[model samples]
Target chain A: MTYHVHGVSASGNCYKVRLALEQLNLPHVWHEVDMMNGATRTDEFRKLNPNGKVPVLVIDEKTTLAESDAILCYLAEGTPLLPDDRLERAQALQWMFFEQYSHEPNVAVARFILQFLKQPGDPRLPDRIAGSYRALDVMEQHLATRTYFVGERYTVADIALYAYTHVAHEANVDLSRYPAIRAWIERVRSQPRHVEMPGVDQ
Target chain B: MTYHVHGVSASGNCYKVRLALEQLNLPHVWHEVDMMNGATRTDEFRKLNPNGKVPVLVIDEKTTLAESDAILCYLAEGTPLLPDDRLERAQALQWMFFEQYSHEPNVAVARFILQFLKQPGDPRLPDRIAGSYRALDVMEQHLATRTYFVGERYTVADIALYAYTHVAHEANVDLSRYPAIRAWIERVRSQPRHVEMPGVDQ
Candidate 1:
């Protein structure tokens, strides 16, 4: 019973799961969905995930998990992605939560509005950009002293944040302003088996 | 080195950690930070958590964890709060993620704006309220069939969601429309050693 992950190639939410699976060296199939074609809204996909979101993980035909962070934690368990030390594990989760609450909502949403929605100069753009910068400043301050989000080593928490932060500049979020975060992004990119988001390498 | 959680009673995020501690019957001291007084902005508190958000769980003298969900996972680890089965664990994390992305940002933020910020019926209120209802609708639909958020029994996932949804009405989110969620709220309340959020019992 091979694991299966359903998502498109370009989604950061989906990239979180993909990065974890690859890092863990887990063998799985990528059931691609052309989200642009409205494949995710189809009744079949809705049955798999009622929220009709991407990056649903199906394992052994018995357990189907939705939400990218959940899928990352699920696959990363018992692996290096999760720390064995109890406090370190908690710290990893802490950063993961920050990724969701502070980082993703601002950075991802800003990128969505700018790139996907093509609303670069919309009235909401300024505030969204400001919010993204605030989040980046927070991350920059944290990463200023540490190599990873938690502990001395990389974990799923890093993967969760890296999924979107790396592409933040694409949305006009000037990474040059945050030297530490920019350096940390390079560190994450240099990891073994690390894969950049589609078209990013090209 | 006694375990200490740094948080105030009034915060739902803090309450989630406190509830987990009480549910597990873990002995811990509470070091309250008055966010209204800007205690969280202090340098010392920021060192414990660069994010400066509570509750920060300090275990022994060397280990400290931040983020409510992370603290919940940390304290619940190796305890009954965490599911042993891999699939069940994944499901627990899935709901935890849902609580963060779908539930908390809407429900909790609405409460913060209305209850604390005293901005109820503000121009932003309608959209925030609508978002909360959309999340509630999703949860109600899921709870319509299942007793708990994940497995047949309650897990930390329930504790995470229950922390906010139980008090959602105060934020103008009428749970009465969702009988399943309302009933599930009662079920969670009926649990042994259940602790209510501050002012909730009144």
Candidate 2:
């Protein structure tokens, strides 16, 4: 069955679901919401996702799901994007949780503030900017000897991180020091059917 | 197999795993890591979990998993605590993600700031306090007629949220404003084999 995804174009979280759909070759409809315009706050949007966040996946008329990584897991089930091994799956989810907690809050926030809010000099940026580097360091170290985040294959774990991390430069994150992460990014981009984030003008 | 859980007893994220283990009747060993004293920063601890976060589940000599919700999912899989339905499962994870992102960042951070850091008046308090209310409002509205976060049964979703939310009062969160949430919290507490957060003096 075709899925219906509602999300803003530029959001890394939203782009995560989009990337999965592309990779999975799942036929779906996209309804773009301008999150910057407070679209998610509208009552109509809230009815779809009470969390009031973009990236809601309506799998059918009866089932709609939110949370980007959750959507990724749902879409990737029974596919190569999700590892079949139980431990590998948990490890993938571990990194996904890291993306949401340690990585996104800093990297994505900085990107949102600078790229969208256009407030490079905002007072709240310093910590976020610093955190972006710390998260990158963790990823660089983790990727030092591994080709992918989990089980040596491209998985949703990689996609979950790739979403915001690929755009982290907009948050003023310097990717130069992370040789391994840099190589991983190249590897991910080299994957067939890779989709670029919104506004990349691909 | 008995699991080895490395965690800080007072951590809501850590406790989420413990509560699930209790509910699922899993045999496990608890090794408390004193996070306030920089215990997680120890190189020894770092070896087990590079993220330097508590709640690492050592499922075997070669298999250890981190991330609280991820650990809960791993432990709860195939058990009644995890919904068997696909849509219901996604709904469970959606709320778990919300707990990690929206609810935990605010409510747990507030509790950590006050209970652990003993700084109730920290400048970060205002925004975190405000966010706690906003998250509570969403939960309250959603729980207006529901018994659980998803599928009308107690699941990992409730466990993930209950860890920090039940103690939101310690964060100065005015739970009285959300009667639905208050009742839901009580309902969760009534679950058989539920465990209390550390430092509850139980």
Candidate 3:
């Protein structure tokens, strides 16, 4: 079945689903949403995702899943992309939640403000940038001792985090001090069937 | 083996773990962290969670899991609290992710700022409250036709969302307009072995 993905190409959350689908060799069709133009705010888009967020994976006529990380788990299930062990699977989810809660809100929002909204002087930028570094610090500390986020293997957890961290510069967050995360990012990039997110400059 | 959970009682994130344990009849010990006194910031707490967040579930001496939803998934695995079907599991995770990203950050943070930090005048409160209502609108729309967050049965998704949502008034966000959510909250409260999170008034 061809998965129908409604997303914005330049969005890291959307990029996560695209990357996983490519790596897993899943059949999929991408439908780009004009988020900046309020495409997601339309009633038709809200039917796909009531939250009006990007990266909605329509599995079939009767089934649609939102939330990029959840979509990753769905697409990665029974594949090498998802861990086999129960604890390891939970650990994978741990990092994904961390990405959404601690990392993305800071890193992704900062990038959105700067790249999409073009509002460098926005008041929320300082807190977002500072929080981005804090999230990076936690990631750096974790990656300092491991090859991957879970089970020493590349899993959806890695994909979830690598999405925004790789493009943090667009958020005005520097990675110079996070040597471990930098190395990890390269490792993620070198993974088989890895796909690059379209640069924000696009 | 008994699980050791380190968390703060007043935190909705931590209460998620406690509630799941109680309802699932799992053997666990709770170690309440003095978050207001900087207990999570201590070096010892960092060993439990580098992120320095609460709701750290220690499965054993060598294994620890952070992120409240991840812990819920861990504790709920193989139990009825987690769904058995692949799509249903992903659906459960979808709501959980939604809770973390779209719901908790606003609802939970607003509650924290007000009840815990006693910051009624905090500048972030307005945006937080507005975001909380937007999140509630999504939940209310979803719950308008469903008995639970997933599969018409109680799952961790409900547990995850029920944490902060039931206490949203503490965030200074009203629920009078969200009849569906209010009804669902009552349904969640009626679940077997349901435990109350200590009131902020305590």
Give me the candidate number with maximum TM-score. 3
Arrange candidates by DockQ, highest first: which order?
Answer: 3, 1, 2
Candidate 1 ranges with C-alpha deviation above 4 Å = A200-202, B60-62, B200-202
Query: Model 1, residue B113: what's the lDDT?
Result: 83
Model 2 reproduces what portion of true contacts? 0.60
lDDT of 1 at B182: 89
For candidate 1, write residues B1-202 as lDDT tens digits. Answer: 3579899787788898999889889898999787777999899998787777878888866667878888888889898888878778878888787788888888888888888778766777777778888888878888999999877788898999898898888778888789999899889999999987886322
* TM-score of the second chain for every model: 0.94, 0.97, 0.98
Better of 2 and 3 by TM-score: 3
The lDDT leader among the candidates is 3
- Measured by TM-score, how close is model 1 to the native structure? 0.93
Candidate 3 runs further than 4 Å off: none
**TM-score of each prediction:** 0.93, 0.97, 0.98
TM-score of chain A of 3: 0.98
User: Which candidate, 2 or 3, has the higher DockQ?
Assistant: 3
Q: Taking chain A by itself, what TM-score does each prediction score? A: 0.93, 0.97, 0.98
**Residue-wise C-alpha lDDT for candidate 3, range A61-170, written one tens digit per residue:** 97899999999999999998999899999999999999999999999999999999999999999999999999999999999999999999999999999999999999
